[model samples]
Target: MAPDPLRSATTTDDTAAIGRLGAVLAARGRPGPVALGPHGPHLVTSVADTRRVLTDAEVFRFPVDVTRRATTGEHAMVARLRPEQVARGTRTFEAELSRATTGWDGGGADDAMEVLRLPVARSTTDAVLGPLETMCRDHVADLVLDWVDSLAPIIAATRPPRRWSRARREERRARTALERSLEDLRVEQPTVSAVELAAGVQVPIAAGAWLLVLLAQHPQAAAAARRHDLAVEVAWETLRLRPPTWVTARMTARSVSLERGTLPAHAVVLVSPLLLGHLPDLLPSGSAGPEVFDPQRWVGGDVRPGSWLPFGAGPHACPGRSLGLAQLTALARWAADRHVVLTEPARIDQTRGIFPSPALLRCGAVPSSPEE
Candidate 1:
């Protein structure tokens, strides 16, 4: 009914609004209908409160479409065993990631960063959507961008009718491509496939790409990530900073006092992981030094229980975290990291400009081998 913070972040005038979100989330209530309406603008803090609200599923609901409320009927049906299925799907996801990384490597040939982008997407697509009809080693960058926009238009006001129409057609093609591939998988490896898992793949893949973009920018952090026992820290760090879903929305089920202000039913709340990740006090840059890259910061503290939310805090938390972690690990282990000379990192744009991506990350690769 009102302005959508998620949508607003992509516009020209969103600078102030996005800044409001950062500030409000840094100090106010957990994001949702209540704090959003109560505070001067909308930026949600209170990770604990946000977790509480999300955990109380009966109160906060998410729908796949506009006409519905709550995870019921089709939504509930799909989510019923999502957790179990995701666990089962992980093995396959990992296997594909491994293949993507090493399938082309030879015993005596030079190994590059394995030519990232497309290969990641190719195996990712296969893992999520079933083996693609073709084994395209190259990822479709423009295709993926168009697909994301089609799902959530960056420019909401108006797209050229022809452009929108073309996107719609391409979107259908992508799904249909997956569907056809799924059919083939069923015929060959039916034991390993599940429709729900297929459906869940896109979100994580897109989120995975976002992680790549984020990690590539911060090489020092990426170096820290490389030293880890597992890449979960890397995934968590990226998520803590740049969550794929900027703001999670909820309608006030009843009157609520959010400390910042009073909120009535139907008000929307906003939550901010971006603000929470940088809480200098929570991260105390003490004798451990300036708190630059402490994975241990999340190890023993009260962080994951409620306060720190990279993959959200509660029940409706993102379920695709494991798959994301696997993908990150696969990339990390196989990485022939070229020094990250970021030409321009992603920016919070308010004008007619594109969101940040690795346009020209000019760095020499430390190829996995010496032979040419």
Candidate 2:
């Protein structure tokens, strides 16, 4: 096979390493899975293989945590988020975001990631934490955000930090604090609630920030999305181009034979929605091509939005998928009419899950609503 042209591009841009990796993999012109190294850790790029690797838990297992072995035997359960909860969360996010952006007047720039943290945290808290006094709910939401922040260093490290390291210590402190708070509230399964709140709050904040950055970069799409229906389409396109959870990993439970090749036991396997989103066959053909951002390709609904598995697929898929989509759609609607402009070039931050770094934007004056 010929060397991919994107290989050079990948090396030059440190910020977009993950994205460039996906691009290079997609450009290889292979119809099957590709290996990252001769020894193993293969990349599953094709749609069928991606689905098979993620959906088959027996053969491909989630990475085992030796520290959590005590709870490993418990059957993992995913709580189904109710429709009413999603609706309530969406409303809460919109209101919170409106409050967060109140002072913008195109006079100064704001970091999208920083601006979005509390609103996303509070919105997710309201949806998942159940009824509580307003003050109590807000306090819990704040604690969750603190816990999420403390986790960044631990997650971004090349290897697991030592138990006594500063990163690990900070994370332990945050987790203990949040767990105690949840217990005080009489929440069932405090450990589970902590995990849910962290996942629910953190992922959406990254997603929402990306939506704003993409909107600011693509004014034409933003203008078209002024219509509510088009805004929803824009949300789908943002997720397609840059799903926060861009890559996921699974370990082979035992030696297995796949259509493409054979893998030894305990080999690490990877699946990436980012790479799948770049495949021409998986997306609708457009004048601009799959690599370009064009929301109109989804107009006729010819190709389903999630064929690339943005939120993932199968039994282990994100349980808060509906609420996450609703939150992003609401954000798209809010940004549609606003003249949001980037103050600086946004770089991809892949230390943890991918997010926009220094996602600074200047907003124009808000237009009065139709009812106003």
Candidate 3:
């Protein structure tokens, strides 16, 4: 059978490529751990198996030096921060969204991803670094985005490149720029490091873009977002379908048992939240389309949301998840008020985390009830 075009861009070397490989593994129907690619890195296909690997952080510890060694995991910082911090961050995000969308006249063409860049960046920067002069905040946001872009090639490479490679050099330069920009803040907030701030900033930018892309593609979902208090559901639905960080890896500390086989110690283990999201049993039964975008499915409350672990699960799950959802929700409201339509097909770019490149969207004000 032909590959499912909905889940892919039909590109030979993109996230679709990885999705195709995942499909093969999923077809095996709970087959024991199997190699994800040529040399090694066995994949854990089932949710139960994936959860076991993530939860047992001791055995599958995060590879902190991922540039030099294999690695993948979510944040530890989210758990460390106080609730008030998160609340303050959400407020910052709302303010930033309004500031970012100011010039969007509701009748012009703009790349949805591009539109989100400033607001998401500014919001996250404010949340992480606290109040800053407008110029400094904008400059810092731009640097954070540049650093994120620079890390792409390093991440997408099958194996870590040599220390002096061009990709590594670019990543280092970008990282230095971002760190230098944050140096003053580092001194002020001794406990909050620059690395944590960058992670907190970057992921939401991508995830927020993905949410807009999903809404633009699915009109019903988009309409629901505009007409109701469903940003949380919309955010969850978007994450379910196209989580930016679709793939994460862990190295086994010891031999681990699978349904069909045993993965020896020090083996590379792969898990995909995208694949888990597609499992029939995990989603609502009467939703008519499990694979299609349907935010309403979340309204019934029959099934638990986020079983797919969009932000991740266990101890290593994303710390900024709640805030990330709030940021997306804020954007969703902005998007909801506008009649946003895709100007071009949004292609999946997986050089870094999965995101919609060229997510061009045109926006017009949604008719008010009186206008309607």
Candidate 4:
């Protein structure tokens, strides 16, 4: 079967091939808006077009109803966090990853998703909720994962599930569990709401898990990370290839002119960070090899990151982006410090956000040098 652009972006074992496919589509199609499917939304293909859509909130409003319902209100929060708070969260992430992975000795394989689950869950919980008793934090973490998992089917469905449907029922149950757990925390910190906490907790888990999967698939990048120099670059490279929230949708509040044609009002506009990452114009010259996992390309810093907007853009952009990057960077470093090898092929799971399911890996801790 020929590549499906959406699936190629969302579910792929070979990123390079899929990226090539995206590039071809971008080049051959009209420079402006392109129809995604027979009757699906229109996709904005160019970086300039994407930025315009994300920034011009007056013309392109966030499809809040779609995102909020798919995520069960967890996507509602958008509080901007300070640098100090993000630093603290980074510390939490580092500590949790070290503790969670310390027991691994490369003696057997472990599921990357399972290994990252508790560490990411706890780190995000601590970052947003502050220090709490182990029991309370763990309880909240479990609830957040439950809510995140339940929303997966709702997001993947072609049509929204009915109120009485099993998917909706499960999502409601999970959200209730999370809200109940947040009650006490909300009372203590009224300004920092539970919705904010949920957003912080859920996204990191998915992103962190993807970080591990990428490291396992690309041993060279993983080795660079272990050397203690490429953690940030590794994280950025991974985000470029496999952003968790790969596609974001917006509704055209009013008619908007584009390079190719005019978009009608109320038209659903699709902007995919994954697709943008594959665009040659937005990348460093001669470094447009989107299929390869090469962190060294970021060394010179000629090509600015965030052009793809992995965490999104404009007023509704992710407030936790810095924190998310810090957390993923820490994970990259941790993976670098170990000799991680993939135990099985990783496949993309697109039930909600994109992540590598069954990302089984094995690792042995890197011995410290005498100089250290």
Candidate 5:
């Protein structure tokens, strides 16, 4: 029989492939790690094993060659943004988001992906570039967005595109443009800034977009989010349900013994936050199943919000996690009282990290008072 398009790992729709993979892994009955194919990466489904893979840098190392054009010395140049930098970025993000949504009140449908770009990009640039003039900051932000856009095809392809292919050429063009623009700014480390800005902006945009879509889809959850105290919970739930960085991979530096089996040297290991989020053992005990989107499950706080490692874990975890969460929480608060409804169903786009395709929402004011 022919392979099912949705379940085939080689299917062009990466989103379906991932969804099918998760379902298959979950169907294995126990939370044990499993190999994908004869030589494919070992998929770590259990929280314990996932954590072990992420934390044990010695055994499982990051595949630095994730992309075709790998750079050296970049890691040495990158540093986490200071507290003050995060604060500045948060302020900028809130302000930019407000500006972007000014006319959204009861307005026609707006594409969440399109509307979220400026806020995320500008805020990331502010945090990384640090104290740039307004005009210069916006220019750099635009360049960063352009570069990120150009990288989609290159990053999504199963195999690296030919160096001279249009995808590669476009990616190079985008990267060069952003790098040159950053260099002109005389930033402390232009290359580092470029990397930081791209990493910071792209993920947050996908996350914020997902948050909006979830809120729109779950009216009860959206209503609960109106309470300032519940806004963070709403953000957590969004990440739980639809984390943008759903699946990540690490390479085994040497043979490692797992609870289920031993992986040989130079094997690839996969950890999926999306799959882990579905595990009942890892979530708060509740009447609603793990598949349900109930933010109230976290009210008692018995279980932590990040057990599934939405932003990842250990040293290599996302540096902008705090800022990313803050941005999502702010978006949740903004969406709380609004009657935001999806214009159509959102299909997952897995080209570069999973994101909602055409996450279009129509916004209107909710009733001020409940009807008697």
Candidate 6:
């Protein structure tokens, strides 16, 4: 049998093949949590299986050839904020999030949500990015969105370092923005953390926007999210349905089987967080599981351990997840208690990095419900 060309670019949706990936996991010699396929065999899917692979670096590895090449000379940028750096930045980020939505009287919350979303980029910039963190919300957000925007075209096109020039330009712009922020590092940098420094803060800041987008989708869910009730669970469900990264790409470390069959070593792997969340073993009753949006499941131990990897697993998990969640919880908690309506429905594009950015969410103030 010949491999299908549909799954070539993990960044692009080439076919409906993803819908049938679960059956592949259960078939053939593939067992033990990992499943390799004739088409997308490179990816490792099981929660338990991935736990093993992620924990054991020697057996599995993320080929950084592309990442390294693309990130050339950016090591210092990454190393600047050490573990504490990431922690402190998260703290600073958290404080700001708390400061933003504090003392709300539950009146005109829908309007407040809209106002906040409109200026989110700049507000986020103030927290993470330095001075270049433009106060102009929409345009600032546009700049960030534009950079990720190039991702699809880059992957879809053919040419060696073909997208190199474009990528470099984006990097240069980002670097320049960082350089501006660096000028006042002593004063501006004290609160800065590794995540802020490494990700330029905007990367992680984007999570808030995403949660807002999802909240807009389900009035009830958004209300639940706003109250920060079992926020972690809500966050997990959001990850399941609208994962930041629609697909995860990893370079094979050694020739291995998907608990199923033979697969070549060093193969490019695509693990869909979207697909992983739907596994029956992990989900009590599939995607429609009772705890699907219930945060209580996690609190009551109904939640499966090592089964969810919204921030991902292993060395590459998103470090700023805590900060993102904190902000999300506060926002969710606030919104749920008030009368809110997402006036401007968000337009989302998942083709960006595994973490897709919601391009827009126009908000309008609405009267609070009588419950408030």
lDDT string for model 6 (1-372, tens) is 112112321224543233434343233234433435565545555565555555445545554322133322121121232444334444444555455555433333333322343233333444444334334423444444443333334443344344358665665465445444344444334223322433343333445555555555455545544554656665555555445554555655677655445556766555555556656566543234522443334544644632657666655555445544544555555445444444453433333433323233434343353233
Error of 1 at 147 (Å): 4.7
Per-residue lDDT of 173 in model 2: 90
**What is the per-residue lDDT of model 5 for residues 1-372, given as tens digits with 9 covering 90 to 100?**
122222322234545545435543454346456766677767887788888998787888766543456433124335566788888898999999999998887889989999999999999888877688899899989999998888888888888898899998888888889889877877777766677788899999998988888777666666765753588888898888778888887888789888777888888788888778878877786536676777777887578998999988876778888888888888888887688888887767777777888888898888663220
Task: Show the lowest summed lDDT stretch of 10 residues, model 5.
Answer: 1-10
TM-score of each: 0.60, 0.89, 0.85, 0.84, 0.89, 0.61
Per-residue CA lDDT of model 3 for 1-372, tens digit only, reads 122334543344445545544453354445647685675677777878888888887788675453444445443343544566667777877887777667765656677667776777777777666667778878888887887677777777877888899998998898787777677656453223455656676677778877777766666657766677787788888787777777787888888786567888888887888777878778887763556777778887678988878878887777677778778777777777776677777777766667777777776766554123
Worst 10 residues of 3 by lDDT: 1-10
- RMSD values, in order shown: 8.6, 4.8, 4.1, 5.0, 4.9, 8.4
lDDT of 2 by residue, 7-57 (tens): 221234543554435443443357555667676577776788889888888
Better of 2 and 4 by TM-score: 2
Candidate 3 has an lDDT of: 0.70
What C-alpha lDDT, on a 0 to 100 scale, does residue 202 get in candidate 4?
A: 63
**Model 1 Cα displacement at 41 (Å)?**
7.2
Mark the regions of model 6 whose C-alpha exceeds 4 Å error after superposition: 1-41, 64-167, 176-206, 222-228, 284-299, 304-306, 343-348, 354-372
What are the Cα lDDT values of the candidates? 0.44, 0.76, 0.70, 0.70, 0.77, 0.45
Number of the top-ranking candidate, with lDDT as the measure: 5
* The 10-residue segment with the lowest total lDDT in model 4: 1-10
Off by over 4 Å in 4: 1-30, 64-77, 187-192, 225-228, 365-372
The CA lDDT at 225 in model 5 is 58
